[model samples]
Target: MTLYKIDEVASECNLTKRTIRYYEEIGLLSPQRSEGNTRLYTREDIERLKKIISARDVLGFSLQELHRYIEVVEMLTGQRERYRSITDLEERRRQLEEIDDTLGKQLDMMESKMRTIQSFKEEAEQLRQQVREGMERLGRQSVERAEAEH
Candidate 1:
């Protein structure tokens, strides 16, 4: 049962001490303390912290979403360990599938919005050209009026 201090774990994971502390404050990691009240992190804790960072920063999971997954898994198992129940895993899989569907819908919406914006830009350019032509015609008419009056 080898344990690492906060600094050692942070250096090993290429993360800053402040980031690790913040994760702890956010209920992500929970390291134990020695008899002298020094924080001692286990290998399991390190693995969980690494997973959280990877899921959030690398995989683009929001903190709230990742926390919800972790909480459900933990609740099903009642352990600070990986989940084991078949039913719970199935439920998680279903939830993930729903998330995928929702993301697909959002992507379709974004594409539609992009098309609309592009159309608006084209219309604006055409309107600008028309305004320029109108101004030039008005200038020519004004010159003709001034010459006739002279």
Candidate 2:
């Protein structure tokens, strides 16, 4: 197995050495050690780090949640590799379907909210125009009356 120094791994992943070490300390990664106590990372380790960071920052998962997902992925990988479990595949498919459904619902809700806001803005604009017209009419009437009285 080819070993990568901390700098090499950081450069490959576009993250700082401190961040990588912190992730390892926090149980997010488990890079192997060489004979000289150097950290050696496999391709799988890099992929896992990518997943962890993306899940936390992009998908808004907490560290604990991301850790759980990493464990799940690891377990699924093992099961698929060793046992070739069809049930695990089916479960993953179901989970993805549920995620799609939830995302669709959220999109619908956001669209509804946007429509409501647009309607309110239109109504407010119409009311403001009416108020302006009413004021102008009242001012003209008052001026004519004053002139006639004078």
lDDT of 2 by residue, 1-150 (tens): 666778888998899999999999999999998888888888888888988887666555667767766766675555444443345877767655655655565455446656776899899999999999999999999999999999
Top candidate, metric TM-score: 2
Clash number for each model? 0, 0
TM-score of each: 0.50, 0.54
Model 1 deviation from the true structure expressed as Cα RMSD, one decimal place: 9.8
Task: List candidate 1 stretches off by more than 4 Å.
Answer: 72-150
Q: Pick the candidate with the highest lDDT.
A: 2
- The deviation in Å at residue 147 for candidate 2 is 20
Model 1 poorest ten-residue lDDT run: 77-86
